[model samples]
Each structure stands twice: as C-alpha cells, then as structure tokens.
Target chain A: MEMTGLFFYLVSVLIAGGIYAVLCLALNVQWGMGGLFNAGIAGFFAVGAYASAIVTTAASDKHLGGFGLPIPLGLAAAMIVAGVTGWVVAKICVRLKSDYLAMASVGIAEILRLVIVNESWLTNGSLGISGVPRPFADLVQGRSADLVYLAVVWFCVLLVYILCQRLYVSPWGRTLRAIRDNEDSARAAGKDVDWFRLQTFVIGCALMGLAGGLSAHYFKFLSPSATEPLLVTFLVWVMLMAGGSGNNRGAIVGALAIWFIWSATEIFTSRLPPEWITRSSYIRMLLVGLLLQFVLQKFRSGLMPEKSPKIRSD
Target chain B: MIDFINLYLVPGLAIGSVYALGAVGISMIFGILRFAHFAHGDLMTIGGYGVLTAVWFIPVNPLLLLPFGIALAIVSALLVDQFFYKPLRKLPTIYTVIASFGVALIFRSVAQLFWSSGNQVFTSGVRMPMVLFDTFRISELHMQVIILTVIIAIALHFFLTRSKLGRAMRAVSDEPELAAVAGLDTERVVRWTWVIGASLAATAGVFAGMDTSMHPNLGWNLLLAMFAAAVLGGIGKPMGAIAGGFIIGIAEETVTYTWFSDEAFISPSYKSAVAFFIMVALLLFRPQGLFKGRLL
Candidate 1:
C-alpha cells in the first residue's frame, strides 16, 4: 500500500511536470524563438482553464456553462479561445519593445484576473468550478485512472515538444530567430517583423492555454488560485531559463527539473515546527527565487544551452 | 460640492500621492538602468514593514518613524543592486528585467517570512476627519499625505534641476554613453538612483499602509497603477510621473462616485482597471507620454 501511495505521488509530480513542460515549450516559442517577452502566462492559462471547465463540466446554473462537451472538444476550445485572446493582445502589444510588452501584458493579466473575480457569472467568481472531467475517467478508476492521466499529460507534452522542435528548425522559425536577433536587419531583409511576432505570440499563448486545460482536468476542479502568476508565469519562466531558452529539449528538461525542486522543497518545509507551517510556503518561494538568481549569475545560458546551427566558413 | 471635495477629491489626491512617490522611483530606474525593474513595488513593501517593525520598538506615531523605514528601504535596494543587479549590468536589459522578477519574489517572501502573510495595521480604529470651515471635512492623514507629497515634489524638482548629482543622474538617463564620454560618475549616479528611488518607494509604502492596511501584497496590488502612472507621466520623467499619478488617482476615485444615480459608475472591484485603461490608451495614442518622455 505504501509503495502504491509513493508511486501515486511520483505520478502526480510527473503529471504536474508534464503540464509545466507544455507551458515551457509554449514560452520557448515566444521568448526563445521569437524574442517576445510575455509576462502574463497566467492570464492565458486562466482563460483556457475556465473555458475548458465551463465546457466539460456538467450542467450547473451557478456558472456560465452547461455544454457537457467531450474532453477533446474542451481542450480544442481552450486552445482556440486562448489563441484568439492572444491575437487581440498581440495586435496591440507585439509592436512594442520587449520591456513595454512585458508591462502591457502584466496589466492585461491583472485585468483578466479582476474580471474572473468580479464577473462571477462567467467563472463562478472565487468559488471556482468543480467536477471537471478527465479524458478517460469513466473507463479507468483509482490508481489506474491516475496512470492514464499521467500518460495523457505526457502525451500532450510530447506533442508540444515535437511541435516546438519542428518549429525550431523550420524556415518560419529561422525567420523568427532573425527577427529576434536583429529586428532592423530582418526588416531590412524584407521581413514583416510585426506580423511574425504576432503569429509567434498567438501560438505561444495557445500552447499555454492547452497546458491550463490539462491542469484543469488533472485537478478535476478550477479556481482563481490556479491562475496565480507566481506559479503559472514566473515559475515557467524560471524553468525555461534554467533548462535553456531556445532549445525545445531544454524546455522539457527544465520543466521537470524545476518542478522536482519545487515539489521536493515542500517535503523539507512540511517538517518545520507548527508555527512555521504557515510560513513554510514563503520559505520555499524564497529558495526558488534564490535558485533563479544563482542560475542566472552562474549559468547564463542555462543547463541545456541553445546551440544554434553554425554557418560553414568553407 | 462639499461631498465631492470631502469624499472623492481628498481621497483621490491622497492615493495619488502614494502612486506618485512610487512612480518616480520606477521612472528614474527605467530611465537610468533601462529596465522596467519589476521589484520596485516590492521595495515599497520593505518600507511599510520597516516602519511597522520600528513602531513595535518605539510605539510612536507611525509617521514619526517614517525615516527609519525609508532608510531600511534604501539599504535593501542598495544591497539588491550590489548583489543581484550590478553583475547583470553588462548583459541585455532582459536579464535584469527577469532578475527583477525573481528579486520581487524574494522581497515578498522575506516580508511574508518576517511579518507573516496576514494584514498588519499601525494603529487600531479610525481617526475622525477634521472639519474645515464648518462645511468641508477631510481626514487629517489625507491632508498630511498631500502636503508631504507637495513638499517632496518641490524638493525633488530642486534636487533634479539644481543639485550636481541630480543633474548627473539626468545626464546618465539621457545618454549613458555620452554621459560617460563627458566624464560623469555613472556608478555614483546609479547608486544615488537606488537611494532616491528606494526612499521614495518606502515612503509610499508607509503612506499606503496608513491609508489602508499593510499586507504582503499591499505594494504588489498597486504595482499596475504605479506603472500606469509612470508611463502616463512619460517614462523617465519624475515630475511627469507625479502629475500622471494624481490624474490616475483622481480618475480612479471619481469614476466610482455616484453622479447620475445611486449605483457606482463602475464596480469598485474594477477600479484597478481604470489605471490599466489609461495606460493602454496612452500607449496606443501617445507612447511618448504627455510629457514627451523617452520613446523607449
């Protein structure tokens, strides 16, 4: 029984890690390949999560949805909704400098959060939506159900990873890298910098939406807490930076490694005295933050540094 | 008229003072360092908590211990710069921006570790408003906040325009490469930037605490508004930030006032959006800002 319990814990960690991998890949598409700094992964994630929750969950008068759609449809809806939202934001902000874009995106995310909280009819407010369905929940039960979900999560990660990998080497991806590396030169070369950036932003945000939908199904519940920027935005950033920015494999590796560190720290923090129980989370956060500083200073390119294809001198 | 003066205008200006104080720091840092400095708001958190901790020891009026808080914030900002930011100065500004996010987390966590996450107030219960001319009523705290901000603004203006270091700072912001060519002490200006920025942020934090309650998220919750004010005033312009702050603060407060009927013009919960709206509109229409600040 203890072995099974331990196994389940490991499975859950992997599930969460897989979701983060998808998010990292999404981010890699933007910040890594496109050189677009999207500081509001949480906002896009929230949009996707609530969209999926409302679509997949059984009829409830409390919130907006009674769709009772299939899990696949819910996931598709998540991507589409998030992609459209990203398109709108990209139209406005993609032309700005990286720093300005970051600030603008943060503002948009905050506004989205406020909307989630204030517009209770749509999101059920802070109360959140429950009974969110998993992909194969009716078929599998108990530990096996978790194993199935784990497989599903990893499958999504694999799909996103493959997508990102392909995009990294594709001509389109090369153009993006050109735009990111030297916008003036790229523009001089007849590239539509703004349009390329807009496309990259939308794609990245859509992937973040997929991750959010996966997490919603995994948790079987959705709440405002799920969209917390500390976890959704900053942590994903740390993962990408720690693993590697431009490399697709680095995104996956960074996601799992950082997720492990994040989860393992909880074990140590849980052992703190009763008074420190409430403060343990903060300590964990401090540790993660310090780790980022250390990583940034020491490993500028991250663990799996980007190795761009070199042009032959011959 | 009295109700508008007492209820909307006074509170708006008071809150505007807080935003202006914080925005000045953000603007200066952006102008000089060329990064958004995501952690500026967290620096304000350090100030409020600093005062809170000091009050525990002295048990005086919170305002009396404000300097200590300011000093604490300055020290913290300087340390952060020395340790985290100074090394990244050579890299792309994105590195520093990302590092600032991490630093923000660290500051908030430190506050949470030391003070706990719950809300803390300097004094219990509310103070009565002072009645002026037997018609208009205003909170003593609000009056003090506005007056102190005005004084600070005048001092800041003089310091920026008159003081040697202040002029040097502006020079660095305008053209760092040129400033260095002109033999200005860029490092010293950077250090002083942190000092001025941190002190003002701390003052804003304490004032914000006085206006409401101090929690771990106090400064963070107001971060959007401060950034909006900074951008609205034009990036890198301190005086512009102050004006932008007041405009945003007043708009935020007055927008919710019941002008036509009993219902608010907008939901109180969405007041934060007002700053965001103003910022986006400004970005769309006039990226150089009202003051014709730096385009970058």
Candidate 2:
C-alpha cells in the first residue's frame, strides 16, 4: 500500500478505535462503576446516530431532517435523545435484578433495531440515510477531508477522555464505586441507589450516543443495519472486556489494538492465496472467538486496571 | 373462529411443545446456576447439526436419529459444562455468563465453518400425514410433538418427586450450600442437571429441525423465546417453562395471524421481541411469574 493509503487506513482504524473507545468508556461507567450490566448500549448508540443524522442532514423530501444544523448542535441533539432513552430504560430496568436486567436490555436493543429497520418514515428504513456532512469540509477541501475529520474526531476523543477522568476521581465516582461494590451497603449509608444508577446510566448513554453520531458523520452515511447487534453491540462488549473494563486508558488501548488486528487480518487474509483467502472469512470469526476466549482466560481483568489514587494516612 | 382455532391453535401447540422443552432446559440451568447461559440456544443448534451430521453418515430412520441426536446433544452439553461452565464456577456468576457467551460464539463459528451457514432441512421419512378435514388439518408430526411433550413432562414430574437423584437435584437448585451441608452431592446433581437439560434441549432441537429448518442460528434465535417461556412460567420451574413456551408460541403465531396480512412478512425476528414484551409485562405486574411455586 502507498504511504497515503496506509495513512488513510491508519486514520480509519483510529477513527473506529476512537468511536469504540468512547463506547467502552461509557459502558465502563455503567457496568464497572454503576454495576449496571447494560447489554443494550448499541440501541442508545443507534438512537444518537440516527437522531443526529436526521437533524443535521438536509431534510428528506419525504421524511424528517435536512435542518442542516452545525455538527456541534447535531451532537448535542444526539446526546439529549440518547440520554432520554437511557433514562427511560434505566427507570424500567433499575427495579429488576441482574439477570432480568440483562434480558430486558437485550430485548430493548433488539426492539430499537427493529424500529430503526421498520420505521422507514423516520430513519429511511433499511435503505438508510446518506450524504451527511463532515465538520469543516469547506476549510479542509478535497482529499484532505479524511485527515481533517481525523483531527476533529481525535479532539473530541481527548475532550471526552478528560471529562471521564475528571468524573472518575470525583466524590460522585466514590459513591458510584461504593454502589457497585455493595448496593445494599451504599443504600444503608444514605445513598439513593436508584437515583445514582439512573444518573450514571444517562451520562454513559449520552456519551455512547455522541460516539454514534461521530461515527455516522465520519462514514457520511447512516444505516439501520450498521447498528446491528453483533457488530455495533457485541463487538463493543468484546473491546471493553479485552481492554480492562473499568479503566478508560485500557479501553482506548484495547479498542486501538482490536481495530488494528481486525483491519490487518482483513487486509492480510484477503492478500493470501485464493483458496486460503476464500476460507479466511470463517477463520477470521474463529480468530475473534479464540482471541476473546484467550483474553477471558488469561487476562480477565484486561490489560490495565483503573488507577486508584494514593491514600494519605492522617 | 372455530376453523382458525383448529388450524393455527393446533399447530401452534405443537410448535409451543418444542419451545417448552427448550425452555425447560434453559430454566433449569438458570435457576440452579443463577446466570443466563446464552449458549443454551446454540447448544440446541449444535444438537440440530449433530442430528444432521448423524443422518448423513448413517442412513437411519428419522425416529432412530432423534435418540442419536439427543445422545450427541447430551455429550456436547457435558463437554461444554466440563470445559467452559466448570472452570468459571468459582468465579463470579457474571464471568460464567460471559464465558457462556464466548462458548456460544465459538460453537456457532465452528458450526458455520464445518456445516456452512446455509440452512439445512432435516426430514424423517415417517411422514404419516394426519388430515383432520381440509382446513382443520393436523399432522402426525404435530401429534408426535404433543405426545413427546406430555411424556417428558410426566417423566420429569415423576423423577423430581420420586427419584432420589431427582430430589437431590431439586435440593441443589433450591439451595446449593444447604444441600451440600445436608449430605447431598451438589456437584453430582449439577452434572446431572446439565446432562438432563442438554438432553432436553437436544431433543427439542432435533424435533424442531424436523418440523422447520435447521440453521446455525436456529437455537440462538430461539433462545429469547425460551427465555420468555422460562421467565413467564417462573425460571427454573420445569412445568412453568412448558406452559410458558406453549403460551408464547401460540401467542406469537396468533398475533401474527391477527395483526399482519402476510404471515410470512411478520417474520420470526419479531418473535423474540414479542416474547420480551410479554416478559416485561409479566415482570411489571407479577415478578414471581405466573405459576408461583418453587422455581428451581
């Protein structure tokens, strides 16, 4: 591959990695910090992406959107929609135990996807919506669009990371940890467990939505199929589990590593002999499964544990 | 209305019987282990594949293959328990759940690689088609399903109530630690539980494959439906799972007939969602499930 081509691939991988990193961080907040095993993160992500796509894109001649708002405002709309959806799901699910919650979330995710697929009037259905505008397209111009978009995405990633870090060390973080470790104990200590969980879930879902919006904008298209359970949801879970669930830095690293492996495998395997490459697609799935098994067995806690601050003894 | 009941209701019952069998297995595992074994559905898929593979090798009667398929499914279940579920027993329940997800993924991938992802039709030449007057027709296959469901339910009831080992299994499910302290071999019971559960799931898978199409995702897709049944009937209650499965299956079929113009367009994809909707509704009003009794 040429240098520019390689750079584009790298940028693509980084973009995918960044989006997933955001997803993982959001999941970590819900699952690791709040002890909410949210199997429906993809639903919120889809909602955000679709919401933003509809808002910023030219209003369809037949359907909603084409308001053509700026990217920032679109992102905000995505967050708001995702947050509200999260709050609704959390309210219904928070009353249930873990297993029921997982089942409910999975159901919700499937339902959301179904709505996206079937609601042709709103989301353009299976045909999907395209021609989404990228940030600063006019300024960057031409082939530089990719690089400019990459820079913009990374900037947003850094901002989210910093924000997450700040939240992780705050008093709110301590309360979340306490709740995660022992909800009953936290409740006994005058903590409103339900409210705390709801807040955390909403925040995490908002981040997830924003990531989805960013992804849609980067791809310049939005499709219901793009938000399928296996790809958008299960892949994120795999990334988070492999990276160390609670640690944001680990999440980012894991996302990057997995994306690199996935992309390279696609490239390398396709370049191999016809017979081998023909079979590589199956092999690739097996590899992913094996890698997940390996990670689960060898490094259940992931590559990096979240860093805790030093305690000062009085 | 009478014709509709005869046509859809009867067939729905047969389909529901298969769901019941599958759900019983799933409920047993969940009640005892306290985790959603996401791979249970895939185990059924594997069983279906096993039956398909067995039929290809030995040109046995379809009826004969059913038992063989069940046996193969039992072995697969045992293997999964040994390698995947057993190791994670000491870890948190979440780890075991996650491991099961991995196991399911691996099984599906391996199945896809070996058998190919294309759907396979499993047929038993014993096609004694029962025609109950043109529109209100019932097939021998449907009869077989109902008979099998009844036999299994009765057998399970007897085993749990009468047999020492069955009682021990119940004891373990009720309270593992207490059962262990009370001189019951919990590990042995758990092993038997997997054996029985997997066997039931396999039986369902084989029968289901015969009734419909056997695909790699057949079991996995049916999982949520099984879950709906299990949860509705009260998780871990074998009889409840049976009832829940039938209710869900019939409801889904009926709902499709009532709501949609083309039954084909209704799609099985929505079946899981329908099941979940039912479950959520149940949970909202009655968290303990319909047949409130001893779950495990």
Candidate 3:
C-alpha cells in the first residue's frame, strides 16, 4: 500500500476506534460504575446521530434538519435529546428491578428504530438523512480532513475518559457504587438511589449521544440500517466484557481490540472463495459465540479486571 | 363487516394461537429458570427449520411433519439447557441473560448458514379456505392453527394442574429449594420443563411457518411478541399466557387496521412497535398482568 493510503487507512481505523472508545466509556459508566445496564446502546447512538445530523444539515422540504446550526450546538442538542430519552426510560424502568430495566431498554431501542424507519417527516424514512457537516471541513480537504476528524474524535474520547475517571473517583462516584451494591443500605445512608441512578443514566446516555454525533459527522451519513440492535448493542457489550468494565482505560483497549477483531474478520470473510461465502458468515458467528464463551469461562473478569476499590480514609 | 371479520378477527385468532404457544413456552421457562430466555426465539427458528427438514422427506402432509419437528426441537432444547443454563444455574441472573444472547446469535447464524435468507414454504396437496356460516372464511391452515392451539393449550392446562409430573414442575417453579427439601426431584422437574416448553415452541414455529413462510429470522421477529404475551398474562401462568396471546394477536391485527384520522398513521412497520408499546404500557400500569403470575 502507498504511504499516504496507509496513513489514511490507519487514521480511519483510529477515528472509528476513537468513536467506539467513547461508546465503551459511556457503557463503562453505565454498567461498570453505576451498575445500570443499557441494552439499547444502538438506540441511544442513533438518537444522537440523528439529533446532530438534523440540527447541522441544511434544510430540506421533505424532512427536518433544515436549521443548518453549528456542529457544537448540534452536538449539544444531540446530548440533550439522548439524555432526555434516557431520563424518561430511567424514570419508567430504573425504579423497579434491574432486569425490567434491561428488557425495557431493549424495547425502547426497537421503538426508536421503528420510528426512524416509519416516520418519514422526521427521519426521511428508509433513505435516511445525508450531508452531515464535519468540523473544519472548509479549511482542509481529503486526507488532511480525515486526520483532523481523527484528532477531533480522539480529543472527544480523551475528554470523556478524563471526565469519567474524575467522576468515578469522587465521593459522588462512591455513592453511586454504593447505591448499586445495595440500594437498601444506600437508602439507609440517606442516598436517593432513584435520583442518582437517573442522573448517572442521563450522563451515560449523553456520552453515548456524543459518540453517535461524532460518528455521524465523521461518516457524513445517518441511517436506520447502520444501527442494528445485535450489531450495536451486543457487540458493544462483548467489547466491554472482553476489555473489562469499570475502568476507562481498559474500556478503550477493549473497544479497539474488538473493533480490530471485527474488522479483521470482515476483511477475511470478504476474501474467502465464492463457494464458501454463505458458510463463512455463519462460521464467523460461531467463532464469535465460541470466543465469547471462552472469554466468559477463562477470563470472566476480562483482560483488565476491575481494580480493587481504593481505601478511603474519610 | 366481511372485511373486518376476515382481516381482523380470523387473522387475530390465527396469530394469537401462535403467540399463545410461544408465550406458554416463555412463561414456563421463566417460571422454572427465573431469567428471560432470550434464546427462545431462536429455538422457534430451529423448530421451523426442523419442520422444513421433516417436510422434505415426508411430503405426505405438513401436520405429519409436526411430530418430527417437535422431536428435533425437544433434543435441541435439552442440549441447550444442559450446555448453557446448567452451568450458569447458580450464578447471577444477568449471566444467563448475556449467555442466552450469545446462544441466540449462534442459533440464528447456524439457521442462516443452512437455509440462507429467502422464505421457505410447505407444499400440500390443496389448501382450501374453510367458510363458516355465510361471509366468514378462514384457511385450512388457519383453522388447523386455531384447533391445534386450543388442543395444546387445553392439554397443557390439564397437565400442569392435574398430572403428577405437572404438579412437580409447578412445585419446582414455586420454590426449588423447598421442593427439593420436600423430596421432589428437582432435576426431573427441570428436565420436564425443558421438554414441555421446547415441544410447545417447536409446534408454534411449525404452524407459524405453515401459515406464512419459514425464514431464519422469523422467530426472532416473533420473540418480542412472545415476551409481550407471556409478560402480559403474567409470567409463569400457562392459561394467562394463552389469554395474553389472544389479546396481543387481536390487538396487533386491530392496530394494523386502525389509524389516526384519514391517512395510514401507524403504518405496517409499527406492528412490533405496537406490541412493544403494549408490553411497556403493561409493565408501567400492570406489571403483574391480567392473571397475576409471579412478577420478578
């Protein structure tokens, strides 16, 4: 491969990996630290992507997204939209048992997908919205633009990672974990478990929304097809599990590793002889299942097991 | 009126029967195992494909293939339980949920690998729509669906309420530890639960495939409906599941027809959304459902 080609290819992978890193971090915050399970990761991701795309893209007669707002404001609107959805879902499902929350989340994700598919005026139906603007697109073109996008996405990932790292170490973080560990005891300590869970859920969803917005802007496209529940929800979960949750750095490693494995498998599958094509995809699924089972049994704690809780002298 | 009867009522009954069979399986497993068996949908797929295999050999009749498909599905259900659920029985509920998700992917992949994507239909000598009274018509397969579901649901009701093994299964679902202490063979109960639930699932899949065409993802689409029906009637109650099934079935058909104002507001794609909305509304207002089975 040419040097420039290689650079672009590598930068593209990094850009994709960085967006996933943000998603993984959001999941870590929800599942790892807050003990909130959001099975509808794709739904939240789609919400943010569409939200940003709608706000930033030029106005069309058929559908929404005519505002042509700035990218930052678009991203902020994405966060608010995703956060509010999370808040409503949390209010409905979080107060009850945890399992209900998981099932409800799945329902919510499917509902969102249905809306995107059926609601023509909002999402342009199946065709989806296009021409999502990128930051600094005017200044740089081609490969340079990609590099800039990579830097921007990674910067966002790093920003979120640092924010999560700081939040999890604070007293508020300790309280969230406490609520997760034992709601009764947390309540005994005067912690409002419901309120804390709601806040953490919104924060996690906002991060996920931000990841989606960045991903949409980078790709310059948004569609219902890209957000399959199994591909988005289950894959993110397996990544989190393999990378180990709770810790932000480990989550990033997990995201990159799984994303690479997925991409590698796709490339490998594409190159297979014509005869073996149908079986190859199935084999891929089998391999993923086997890989997950092996990972679960052998390294249940994941590659980077969560660090032992730090002693607090306070 | 004819259109409403044919379009809404008859189809509702047919679809409701399928959902009833599926919901019964889901409720039984949930009661006995105490986790959402996300793999149940894929199990239905296996049963559907299993029927396809049976029909290939004995094209004499599709109903004749039912027993064969049920047999294959029973073995698979046993194997899945022995392999996955047995190991994680004592662990946290979440492990089983995630593990089931993995298993679901595996089943779907295998089905897709074998059958690929297009729909597969069963060939019979002649399909005649049975007309009841004057203007009411239902297909033979649909009639068979309604009759078969009623028979199975009744048999299941009797088996769960009257039979010794059925009582043992209920006992185990109620309290495994206590049942064991009381000298009920817990292993036997678990095995029977798997057999019964899986058999019902296979039957449902076979008929659903008969009504429509069989595909790898057919059961996956129906999974949420089964969940809604199962949870709607209250989990663990077979009778309630049947009731929930019919309710969901009629509601799905009715919603398809009923739209806001003049235009088709709901659209065809919102069918699952409607089912999900019902499930959510139930969860919010009446989590215990109509019959009030155990709520986890």
Best by DockQ: 1
lDDT of 3 at A44: 92
In angstroms, the error of model 2 at B77 is: 2.4
- Which residue segments of model 2 deviate by more than 4 Å? A274-278, A311-314, B59-63, B124-129, B133-135, B259-271, B293-296
For model 3, the stretches where C-alpha displacement exceeds 4 angstroms are A1-3, B124-128, B258-265
lDDT of the structure predicted as candidate 2: 0.80
Question: Candidate 3's residue-wise lDDT over B199-270, tens digit each?
Answer: 888888888888888998888778888889998999888889999998999888877674566544467678
Give the Cα error of residue A218 in candidate 3, in Å. Answer: 1.5
Give chain A TM for each model in order: 0.96, 0.94, 0.95
Kindly provide the TM-score of model 1 when superposed on the true structure, using C-alpha atoms: 0.98
lDDT of each: 0.90, 0.80, 0.84
| Residue A12 of model 3, lDDT score | 87
Q: Which candidate model has the greater TM-score, 2 or 3?
A: 3
Best by lDDT: 1
Off by over 4 Å in 1: A310-314
TM-score of the first chain in candidate 3 relative to the native first chain: 0.95
Which should have the higher lDDT, number 1 or number 3? 1
lDDT at position A217, candidate 3: 97
Angstrom error of the Cα, residue A146, model 2: value is: 1.1
User: Share of real interface contacts recovered by each model?
Assistant: 0.82, 0.42, 0.47
